[model samples]
Each structure stands twice: as structure tokens, then as C-alpha cells.
Target: MSADQSVAIVDDDDFFRKALERVFHSAGFRTESFAAAEAFLASYIPKDEACIILDLRMPRLGGLELLDRLKERGIDVPVIIYTGNADVPVTVQAMQAGAYAVVEKPLSSELLITRVRAAITDARARRTRRNQSASARAKLKLLTEREIEVARHLTEGLSSPEMADLLGISPRTVDAHRANLLRKLEIRSIAALARLFVLTELGDS
Candidate 1:
């Protein structure tokens, strides 16, 4: 993620929230503070570019509940849970709910920073993969029905002659379709095309 990426800190305690904001700000991260989950959800856009620092306890909807809401909406931002209790069950539950980290309250600046950095890195990787998948889907949309058939065979590592034989088309036509698929996908080689196919499959699944 970029240095401009922000972190949202949601904690009911004013002192802790302000302290966390200061720490994040000093580390070159833009920070926002919300006293409750509802305020944060109402105010923030669910961008995959940002990370969320969530307090496990709050007045209205708790951190776990907020996490569920985000997941249901397919918002893939990274979340780190902060809590004073530090019980084993709570920690396990947070991790199971896809929290990047569960940190105890009276937080360490160093550990918190490290976890935030890791979460941002993970978020960026996921965003990149999603973008690549979108590109692949767009490329696939350019294919004609016959070209798509040829492309699928090519993605399965079939040679031009093999695809021609299987589809009962001329070798020259199969080769033409292969070249068109490459150009449409903006890929230089068959290996890159195959990778795009795999990525598209994974994205759909």
C-alpha cells in the first residue's frame, strides 16, 4: 500500500484512541478515530487500500460483529483487533474471523506498528491479485465463441495442431485463434496466458 493509506481506529475510550492515533501518525500513517463501530462504518469507505484497528469491545456493534459485516459485503480490508481482556477464546475467535492480528490493550508501539505494516502488505497483495483477475476477465470477454474454445484448449497446454484436431479446425485457424487470444489478453507468451487462465479460475472459485 501507499504511504498515504489510512488506518481507522475504533475504540470507545478517548484516551486509548487518541494515543493510537498519535502512534500511527508518527509512523507516517493517516489515522481516523471512531468511538463506536456504527460511526466508523457510517463514515468510512470500505476500501481494500486501508487497514482497520478495531477494539473488541464497544457500545453498539462490537469489533467481531463489524468484521462480519465487512466480510458479508466482500470488503477485503485488513483488520487488527485490540482488546484488554486477552482471553484465549477471544484471541482464537478474532484470528478465525480473519483478523490480521489480535493485540492486547496498553499496546506496544513497536509491535502494533509491525502488525499494521504486515496487514498493509497483505492487503496490497490481495488487491493486486484481484486487479489481475479483473484484467484477465476483461480479456476473456473479447474472445468469440470459437476463439474462447481455442483459448481454453491453449490454456490447458494443447499445441495448435492438437487443438485443431480436437476442434476439427485447420491448424492455421487454431494458430490464428491462439495469436488473437494472446493479443486480446495482452500477454506475450503462452505461459502468461496459462497463468491468466489459472488466475481467472481461482477468482471465480
Candidate 2:
């Protein structure tokens, strides 16, 4: 996690919320507490290196509802749902809705801190990957029409001569385009260029 990474604790229970805050603070981690999910949403603070410890049974905006809203808003912040009662269906739904983990109430302070640190670390990695994909997409936009055409063919495992034949261009011209593509994309191999396409496409999540 980065130096400024934090943990957000959203729960209606004053006792539990303060306990978590103390545990995190004692561990030298930054934290922000919210009385309810709605308050957290209303604040609308986005953190690249933070995760949420969300209570599952809050009134009005419950954990599941908040999870769905986060999904709708394209928020991929890792969430660990905390619930006092262990409901099988709700736990399954939370996981399916993309919760990082679910912990039943009466959680051990040590275990909770462990999970929070792991979630924050995972969130940081995801943010880094997203930034890299965005950078790759921006760089890809610099390519000319012909260069993009060459890039697609390169990803399809086409040799210079094969691509030239398909486009009705000379093999030497295709090779020149390939060279330009490698330099423009700052990639060394055909495989690496193809990998970028895969990474950037999945970044929509």
C-alpha cells in the first residue's frame, strides 16, 4: 500500500466502528469512519489505495445495496462485508457482487487488520494496473490508421509477408509499418503488443 492508503469503516454500531478505528490506528494505518452507507456515498471520496469495511445490516442503504451501487458506479474498491448474523445466501450474494471477503461479527482485531491490509494492498495493485492500461490506451491512440491496421495484424500472429499479402502491400512496406509500430508502442516483441490488447480490454471492469 502507498503511504496515503487508508481504510474506510462503514457501520452503524458506534462500539464496533470505534474498535476498528482504534485497531487500524494502532497498526499505523490511516482510516475514515462512516455511521452509515449513505453517509459514505454522500461524501463520494474516491481513493485509489483504499478498501472499505462495510457492515451488512445497516438500515436503508445496507451492504448489499451499497455493493450494487458501487458496481453500478464502476467502483472496484475491495470490500470486506461484516455481519453479525451469518446468513448463507447473503454471504454468497456479497461474494458474487464482488466483495473481497466476508467476516462474521465478533471479528478478532488481529484478523480484521490482516484482511484490511490485504485488501488495501490488492486495491493498490489494481489501481496500478488500471493506470498502466489507461496509459497504454492513450499511447495506442497516437497510431495512424495504417499503423493501427498493422498492429491488429501483428496481434493476429501474421508475418510481414502474410500481412502484406492480405493488405495488397509490398512485404518491405509491411516490415516498415511493423518497425514503426514497435517503436511507437515502445514494445519489443509481437507477443508483448498482443498482451497489451488483452490487458487493456479487461480493464473495463
Candidate 3:
């Protein structure tokens, strides 16, 4: 590909897979064709610039099943479901499970290539967000239980004395936990720490 991005086609239909690969290659995309979703998952390394073209019907593991498997592994690669058996229910399920786009195949090379490029863009964006969230979580994990409680109270606009009262600790101890949590998270601003929690967690957390 011109931009060093690749598109993967996972379909058991040999002619269709090869034809799709040719179309993508002709349009300046690197293409990998697999005979089944099982094969693709076995070989695929997560790539931010890569997108998958999947078929709903295959011998071993179908597209929907493969999507579940991807999610289980925390793989955020974008997908475009291209299948001859596209129906309303299948389309709904694929989109619900985060497929970038779905296309019914009486194979349109032009449309498929367009969708592939869009999916690649989407996959890259998802990877960027996932990496950011992961970084926040890793930093948050550096705190102990007491430090985490102090951080949570800080997010709720609690002062050191108030946090001490809530945690049944001395005010000096509250201040110490706050300092340690901030240092471990490598963030100096209370608002920034609160923003990290908002982005990565919900409810009582």
C-alpha cells in the first residue's frame, strides 16, 4: 500500500477472495487473503492500519463468531462485513458488534475498496484511543487501595481534612496519599486525574 497499510480478506470462496485481493492491490493496498476466519485469527497480528473484509458464511468459524473472538482478545481492528448472504438480521448483528461497514456482495470493486480505506482509517483511530486508555489504566494501577480512595475523594472536590474524615484517617495521612497517588500517576493536576477516571471508568469507580 502507498501508506504502508494493508487490507485482509477472510472468505472461503477462493475466486472471490483472490478477486478482492486483486482489486485492493490494484488500488495501492497491501492485501492478505485467508480461506477462513480461523486461519486469519491464527496468523493476524493486531495492526492499527489494517482492516478486515469478512464473510458471514464460512466453513469453520463464521464472521460473527470471529468478531466475538476478536473482542475477547481485546483486538480493536476495524471490520467490513462483505457477504453474499447479507440480510437485515445479519447486518444489524455485525453493526451492533462494531463492524465499520457492511456490504452485500455482488462484488463491487469500487465500493469495496472505498469501504476498505474507510475501515483502515477507523481502525487507526480506535487503536489511538485504546492506547491512550491503556496508558491511563496502567498509571492508575500504580496506586494502592488507600491511595485510590484518596484519589476518588479528590475527584469529588474533597479537601484533605474532608478526605481524612471520610476515610477515618489523619489529615496528614490523607495529604500523603494524595501526594503519592499524584506522583505515581505522573500527573500534577487534580482535574487531569479526574478526567482520566471519567474516560476509563464509570459508576462508583
Clashes of each: 0, 0, 0
Badly placed stretches (over 4 Å) of model 3 are 12-15, 35-46, 58-76, 96-98, 202-205
User: What is model 1's C-alpha RMSD?
Assistant: 2.7
Q: Candidate 2: where are CA atoms >4 Å away?
A: 1-3, 72-75, 155-157, 186-192
Top candidate by lDDT = 2
TM-score versus the correct structure, for each prediction:
0.84, 0.84, 0.76
lDDT (10s digit) by residue, model 2, range 6-90: 7899999999899988888787778899999989988857677787989998988999899999988888789999998758888
State which candidate, 1 or 2, has the greater lDDT. Answer: 2
* Local distance difference test, candidate 2: 0.86
lDDT by residue (31-122, candidate 3, tens digit) is 88999887898898877688888888898799989989999998877888888878899899999987888899886788777777777775
**Model 2: how far is 14 from its true place, Å?**
1.6
For residues 22-114, what per-residue lDDT tens digits would candidate 1 score against the true structure? 898988888889998899878878655578999999887999999998888777889999999879999999999988888888778988888
What is the model-wide C-alpha lDDT for candidate 1?
A: 0.85
Better of 1 and 3 by TM-score: 1
Candidate 1 has its poorest 10 consecutive residues by lDDT at 196-205
